[model samples]
Target: MASIFSKIIDGEIPGQLLWTDAVCGVLLDIEPLTPGHALVVPRAEIDHWLDLPGETLAHLMDVAARVGRAQQEVFAAARVGMIIQGFEVPHAHLHVFPANSASDFELSRRSSRTPEQLAQDADALRAALRTQSDGAHVPGEA
Candidate 1:
């Protein structure tokens, strides 16, 4: 069976995707520590970040940076925090979240968003990414 991340990438389930490339995909965390919390996940379901091929890891971070920048702008965060905790899901994923303080980095604070809020947040990030990306389409930009 595919990891849930893979299922999201494959459209088997809905996800608020922020970016996508041949190597990886960035999506919003359904349960977010803060608004604009995003996940940078490899298309391949590697179970551990350390086990990823070096180039793949690099690509993931590069995309994560772009997503984080959009999150920072859209959420007006003081900083964007990055974390890797593979326990919740088998697939290796990097969590990139908008942060106003150290307390915003706590995974224990994750909360679910309503569908309306998710769509609104997605639009905000898409607009920011459109400007940042020089008009390139961010994943699921609509």
Candidate 2:
């Protein structure tokens, strides 16, 4: 069975996508610790982060860094937090969110947002990401 993230990547389910490449995709988290939170996920369904191939893991982190940079700028965050807590979903993913302090990194702090709210957050991050990169990874980019 495909993981929920796989379903989102495959278009079987909707995802507020921000970036995509051959190896991975970035999407806004519905249950976010803060606005502009994103998940950098590999296209392959590897359940454990440590199990991913070196280059593949590197690519995911590289993408997460990009999202973190954008989050810092757009959200005016003092720091960007990242974590690999795979319990929520079986597919391995990194949670990247704007953090003003260490406490912002807590996974138990996640809060749900309506689809409209998530879309608004995605739009803000997507616009910020477009300004920093080639803009190719941003959704609806031409």
Candidate 3:
């Protein structure tokens, strides 16, 4: 069975995608800890982060760092956070978000945003990513 993340990646379901590459995709979280919260997920549905090959893991981190940088710049975040909690979905993923304090790491505090808000956030991140680098991996800009 395809994981929800896989479905989103495959366009089986709607997702607020911010970046995409051969290895992984970055998308805004529906239930976000902060306004620019995003997830870095591999295309392969490895259940645990440890199970991923070293090269795949490295690629995911690289993408995550890029997204983190964009999030910080776009949100004026004090700091950026990355967490690997595979319990929510069986697929491996890194939760990257703008963090102002330790409290921002609390998963229970996630808030829901309407589709319109998510689309706006995605657009902002895409625009920021385009200006930050070559943006070869950003969907529309690439």
Candidate 4:
């Protein structure tokens, strides 16, 4: 059976996508610790983050980093937090969100947002991403 992320990648499910590459895709999280929270997931449905090959893992992190930068631009938080507790889906993914303190990293701290809200956030992050990728001065990149 395909994981939910795979279904999203295959277009079987709707996703507010920000970035897509050969190895991975980034999308907004419906349940977010904060606004601009997103996930960077590999195309391959690997269950465990540690089980991913080194190179693949590195690429995932790189994508997550880029998303973090964009989230910082969109949310303007003190920092962007990353979490890899992959229990929600079988596919390996990294949760990246804007954070002002340690409590912002807690999964229990997440709350649901309406689809409209998530979509708006996704759009904001997408715009920030495009600006950074297009040679703009992205926040959090000193």
Candidate 5:
């Protein structure tokens, strides 16, 4: 069976996508630790981050760094946090979010966002990405 992340990447379900490239996609988390929390997931349904090819792993990190930069700018975050906790979803993914302090890293602190709020957050991050050097990876951009 396909993992939920694969379903989202394949468009079987809706995702508030911020960036999409041949290798991976970056999208806002429905359950976010902060206003701009997002996920950097590879297009392939790799079950563990450790099992991914070196090139794919590098690409995911590159994408995460891009999203983190945008998150900092858009959210005015003191720092950007990233984690590779694969317990929640079988498919490997990195959670990237804006952080002000160490406490912001707690996964238990994540909270749900309404569809409207998610859209607003997505719009803000997408706009911020447009101004970034990696802006070309953002969907619907020139």
Candidate 6:
């Protein structure tokens, strides 16, 4: 069975994507701990982060770091946090979100966002990412 992440990756389900490349894509989480919360996921379906090839892991983090910067630009948060707890979904993913405080890290703080909201947020984030020094340019401007 394809994981939900895989479905999103395959466009079998909708996603508010901020970045997309050969290795991975970054998208806003419908349920976000913060307004700019995003997920960096490998295009390939790998259940555990540790199981990914070293190069793939490196590329994922590199992209996550770029996305983190974009989140900072769009949200103006004090910091951007990264979490890789793979228990929630079968596919490995990196959660990149804005954090004003440690409490912003809690999953319980997540709130549902409408598709329109997510799309708007993704648009802003993609614009921010494009302006950053090392940020990626997603096709269709994300």
Which candidate leads the pack in TM-score?
3
Residue pairs clashing in model 3 are none
Candidate 3, 8: how far from true, in Å?
A: 0.8
TM-score, model 3 to reference: 0.96
Q: Candidate 5 overall Cα lDDT vs. reference?
A: 0.89
Off by over 4 Å in 3: none
Model 4: per-residue lDDT, tens digit, 49-104?
A: 99999999999898888899888888889999988898888899999999999999
lDDT per residue (tens digit) for residues 76-129 in model 5: 999999999899988899999999999999988999999999988988889888
Q: Which scores better on lDDT, 4 or 6?
A: 6
Candidate 4 lDDT score relative to the true structure: 0.83
- Ranking 2 against 6 by lDDT, winner: 2
Which residue segments of model 6 deviate by more than 4 Å?
A: 133-137
Single out the weakest 10-residue window by summed lDDT for candidate 6: 133-142
What does candidate 3's lDDT look like per residue over 1-142, in tens digits? Answer: 9999988887789998888888998888999999999999999999999999999999999988889999999999999999999899999999999999999999899999999999989999999998888888787644
Position 54, candidate 1: lDDT: 97
Model 6 CA lDDT for position 134: 44
**Candidate 1 lDDT trough over 10 residues, lowest sum:** 133-142
Q: Give the clash count for each candidate.
A: 0, 0, 0, 0, 0, 0
lDDT-based ranking, best first? 3, 5, 2, 1, 6, 4
Q: Supply the global lDDT for candidate 2.
A: 0.89
Which residue pairs show collisions in model 4? none
Q: What C-alpha lDDT do the candidate models reach, one value each?
A: 0.86, 0.89, 0.92, 0.83, 0.89, 0.85
What's the CA error at residue 77 for candidate 4, in Å? Answer: 0.7
* TM-score of each candidate structure, all chains considered together: 0.94, 0.95, 0.96, 0.91, 0.94, 0.91
The TM-score that candidate 5 achieves is 0.94
Predicted candidate 2 versus true structure: per-residue lDDT over 16-94, tens digit per residue: 9999888998988988998889999999999999999999999998899999999999899999999898988989999
